[model samples]
Target: MANQRGLATPLGVEFAPPHRADRIAALLAEQDRWSPADMPAIHTDTHLGSAAPLLDHLRALKNLSPKAAALRDRLLAWDRRMDAQSTDAAAYAAVRGAVVRRLAAHPAFAALAAPPSCPEVLLPWLALLPRIAFALEHLLLAEELYEIDRSAVVAAALEEVAVLAPAAPWGQSHRLAPWRALATTSDDEPGLAGDHDCVPCTSSVPGLTDLSARGPAARYVWDLARREDSRWVVPFGASGVPGSPHHRDQLPLWVRGDLVQVVTDFEQLTKESDV
Candidate 1:
């Protein structure tokens, strides 16, 4: 909505906004005059600034368990970026997932575990675990009503994470797994860099799988100043046919976060009769 209103620009990075409208507005004002050449910076901005609050909260807490302390120190030392090769991101995600799961299972929240008598479409809202997983930050900072020992959960989760070491980097696990109508085996899909709140959002359900099943199906940068200067790219190619020349031609570009120039000239395209 902000993009549509010219209050912000869509760089094809994050899907859900961080709810920081004021901050985004400031950023928009700062980059009001950005040109098409600056689009690359927008596309590649994968900083995890949104996670700072949670990190700061964790650091300020006292009497953390050894494992939790170690995890906190490692996260604090991190560059605060969710780069593809970042091991810190992987560790952080693992610990966060554990914390969320443990919190959801607490006796205080047991009442919420029962499925609500709502319509099937609204069933997800009644799922207690996912609610905790998605709104972890809020729950962590919010006033505790149910008297749940959040700190204990965090520590236990950290200890568990330390026991079960995740060897892969963030990108190796946090990959883009596009759903295909026809089941096909291919290892060409690229591992992505970014979290649910990062600029380049490659969100996944923590403690489950890091493979992102949802994202921009197609990315585009429309040059309102000059339509001919616009650029776009799809995950695959122009053709839907299995063995067509255009099939999967754009895969390489999409993986690299590159876009192709939009061709508006009909004369440049060959006629079907010619083919």
Candidate 2:
């Protein structure tokens, strides 16, 4: 029942953002009014990397608001008066060292012999950017995040956030869990970015663990004319018992975006009598 939470609708809903490129293009004429004008019809160039072109976007709307008086004073110290307000990636080169050192401690990061800096990173105004350090970590680790082999990150998504649930359940136990696959989808990029037909979509928000984060909890295809023809799938399986065959049986199907038909016919479903 926990999965059945939030602003879900009873009627048919379009999963993708509905705005068309042409309509959004018109709105964006004034101020690039619909910033995601190129989206949905086609995914954005956004990705988890310092090299993305989106970071070079030059626009601002109150990028910084709250800060300690002393900190603000320090930024304005030495008779400096105004902030440069350059939104470009390369402008913040001076302060990238601290982040580089922190990531260097990770064994996976150290093994690569990566450069001290990824110069393509930028300053952004997202709420997560300033409040959370992992966003910066992702920005700094963009190079590695793009790689094919992410076996080490299967259990390492940072420890700052809390995971709660029934004991040994996925949300609680996934921290020590292993990863069988890695989907290219990410926060800045839609899951179905390159291949719209692809079934696997492993999107994860930055500054958070990749496992059990956010995605569709369940998928359903209700057949209106024939009720039993309907099909559905959940992230886990049917049996709650840990070692049962039915336990986690549908996990592979769920990961592959497959569904199980509804057992509406009384005779087809298991009937508990004397068993």
Candidate 3:
């Protein structure tokens, strides 16, 4: 029963940590310093629905703010260019590589104090940083190229996927998707199949259009003699004070299928909030 993790009868499964993508997320989570060069993280956790906001941004094609319009125009060009390319994975990846280089310089992705940096821009890239560890080990390798970072390919390919398949499928609607997908689900930890990997979606109703509207009301892990080891999380965050960075902070973890560890330790809990 004794092990590095503590005392417990081992189950057949073991859970590991997920990876975080953006450096700006560190600035948001720990109030770390910000640099203009760091591109913000936007829904990088979910390969499927997280980029839906970017799609909506392009829908109002006319009268968008200067930055929004600027970004849209470039994406449109990228969209056309991406579609004309060959399907060989190498060629597909090369196109993305070129597109992302341009994306890096665009104004829409400009680093700001918080999101909503662009006028009339629905997705505030800066404020939208979701500081959650994304477990890339679960992504489907069959259809993806290993040479490129997942986020980079997604950035290059998103416009194409959105323009080609514009519908936002929720919950069980994932089954209808052309590629493999999973519902907003919580399976017993330590054993989620790679193809069936799910996000921490609390509102997984069949027809909902938005995942952010709902979340885990609360989450918990109980510990006995050493009460400090117990952890808890509310829907978003526990920065109970108004406008605390932590108030809406834990959401990314919750959505990306992970949990934050809260210490009840007057009991000296080994703090590992590495989400």
Candidate 4:
């Protein structure tokens, strides 16, 4: 499960140690035998199950204004797939961002706004917005309100997003934005599916940006039965030689989470040198 969790990391969801170990152990124990064909399902089992409780609470909020109620209903109706084309995911993101931003600026959390005196490496933790964004679930559901009306914040956020957010697919804004060795002509990349907490997590820094700065650099499935049946894919391609046909050839496959089969048979090899 460590290996599977590692693969899932690029997608965004890093299962907590306790849950990760138990879940994977349960899955393994349930299987009589495992095959390469079963690897994909095991690896991609990331579902946004974490958000259900919070979503249910949001749906049950009392006396939401008309616009807020409408947005809430839409969210309730969402399939929670977090697919690249999901507009509901985009809407959720917008609302979440707005709420975090508002909370960060609220006087209730003023003391936390001060930058930590610790090292620069720990700066992200000291940032107020990130802190709020990461702990939003707790903030929304906390029994003891911090003198701030959480319900009002959600309603306002929903109304604000309805007017401010562009009508576009979630992937239009949430995409792979990896740091490149060389500057490209365009920043345009493929639309991604999944969320920060999902199995195929495509999470960006919440409250900061929607553009994904981190994701799976590569994907692979090793076949114990037949080594040749193993498959792999990198963000770019197999060949490192620039100007070669193989350069960037695997990109589309990578984008689609597909893999190329490994070839080990010498008979299938194309000899480039006489030995």
Candidate 5:
């Protein structure tokens, strides 16, 4: 059996780990602390454990009337009930009903049958997008939304579910996917396809995080008038040339919405790297 060492460019450098815990620990350590914080702080906050932003956004947008409020409340109530259930199935069913009612009655939900955009910051949350869809269809009468592309959404959601679903889970998906320059190529394909719903705005799944749309990358709107105003490269540059490690080396950080500058100059670089 091949060792399942995973690699990714989550930050500027290639992150290949012998185990998931190693990667998680590296991430947590880099940030220094963990736990969800309010919005402004959320950007700097090292760890975000819950899908609160998605739920809050959905509740805000869908709760247009007293009926919507009642539905939302019921959904919350069911969540609490699920915590105490001896049989998860019964709890899931009740929770599912509330989600369905809330989704079916909302006008905005009409758009779920089509593919949605992948938000920048919320890309990591992509894994959960399908589960959200499953809840929508099973709990909420998703068909009542009357989408011409209903089946399209279901198919896309199922693809995502295949990655983490209990039965015959995508060991390859988890083990070999998300390639890195240092790692071996993966045979497994990502569950998401161009035709599938990929964004919170158009996705059939409710309670999606807004990050799915904007992305987590730092985007600078630089004003050209300033003299010092300009852009720079990361890890120096490609070729791993003596002076420049590699141009556009920070691609992963950019993808993940992290934008700390890579120090290239001897005066600015860390002591160890300079030495």
Candidate 6:
């Protein structure tokens, strides 16, 4: 799950508590245990963080309750099943099935056979970008085809976008834009200067398809070691509603690779629970 939902906006999905990071970690470790010894080829630098959480859980797995261990192992097994997407067709199916069994079993996924197009419209919404944010390694790195053939990477990337495009409203608005934390919102197009054009170069991972670079609506990085070191930004801006003046305010920061520090003080914030 992504930390899409918060006090500031209603158009994003709420993230699972920090404890949930272990689930992904356990699954990845299990995946490595079962997968072939050959390292799968990777397509881009953008996906390095995919399996990072698993490192934290490996030690924890040794001393865990039965329930915790089982969950972790199952997730690991699932990762192994999906590790081979491009060259290994059999492995892909296994992983997909595991996802259906695991993710679909959740009440939230069950209620919506199809996740909402936007996170704001559906609480705990299971959408594309959030899923990609966690599984980027698998999609871009773990699979061998990611590096061998550029065509394969492009096709795979398009498949992901197609999955969520239907549900996404005005999703095309993800073009590069600037973010204003305290400035007034406006509908006029902002000038693009010195701003990295996320359209192709920055957004698209080199050697991969342009579509592959187009990520789900937003991205963020939180460095827990230091509160000030933690920085965040979205493809659009502080607001999620499209056509609103506040919409797409953060485009410039994202394109420029500039991130705003997370404001921990609750008093200095906007609390809008619902869109």
- Taking every candidate in turn, the Cα RMSD to the unseen true structure, in Å, is 4.7, 19.2, 19.2, 5.0, 16.5, 17.7
lDDT by residue (tens digit), candidate 5, 16-70: 1223233234455666644322112222222211223223433444313454444
TM-score of each: 0.80, 0.33, 0.25, 0.77, 0.24, 0.27
The clash tally of candidate 1 reads 0
Candidate 2 collision pairs = 28-33
Q: Write the per-residue lDDT of candidate 4 for residues 24-106, one digit (tens) a residue.
A: 45667887988666655544444455456447657757777677777778888887766777888888777778878888888
lDDT of each residue in 62-151, candidate 1, tens digit only: 777676677778888888777788899888888888877888788888888887788875654457776777677777777874787776
What C-alpha lDDT values do all the predictions have?
0.71, 0.32, 0.33, 0.70, 0.31, 0.36
* Over 4 Å off, model 3: 1-201, 204-208, 267-275
Candidates 2 and 3 compared: the better one by lDDT is 3
Candidate 1 at residue 48, lDDT? 68
Candidate 3, residues 1-275: lDDT per residue as tens digits?
11122333265354322111222243357645432222122211222222223333344445444543444554443322111111221122222333333333335435532445456434422232221112222331235434334444344444443344322222222211111133553322221100111222222211111122333356555555455555555645765443557756765554344545555545665543554
Best by lDDT: 1
Per TM-score, the best of the predicted structures is 1
TM-score of 5: 0.24
Could you tell me the lDDT of residue 145 within candidate 3?
Answer: 32
lDDT comparing candidate 5 with the true structure: 0.31
The parts of candidate 5 lying over 4 Å away from their true place are 1-143, 146-218, 232-244, 255-275
Residue range 1-275, candidate 6, lDDT tens digits: 33212463565544433322343343456544421111111101122122333323322335444543444444444422111122121222222223323333344434445557665634222453345433433443344522334232333333333343222211122233334445666544422211011111123211111112233244445555556555566756786666666666777665444566678888887776566
Of candidates 5 and 1, the better by TM-score: 1
On TM-score, who's better, 3 or 4? Answer: 4
Per-candidate clashes come to 0, 1, 5, 2, 22, 13
Cα distance off (Å), candidate 3, residue 72: 32
Off by over 4 Å in 1: 1-32, 65-67, 114-126, 165-167, 184-188, 272-275
| Deviation from native of the Cα of residue 223 in model 1, angstroms | 1.7
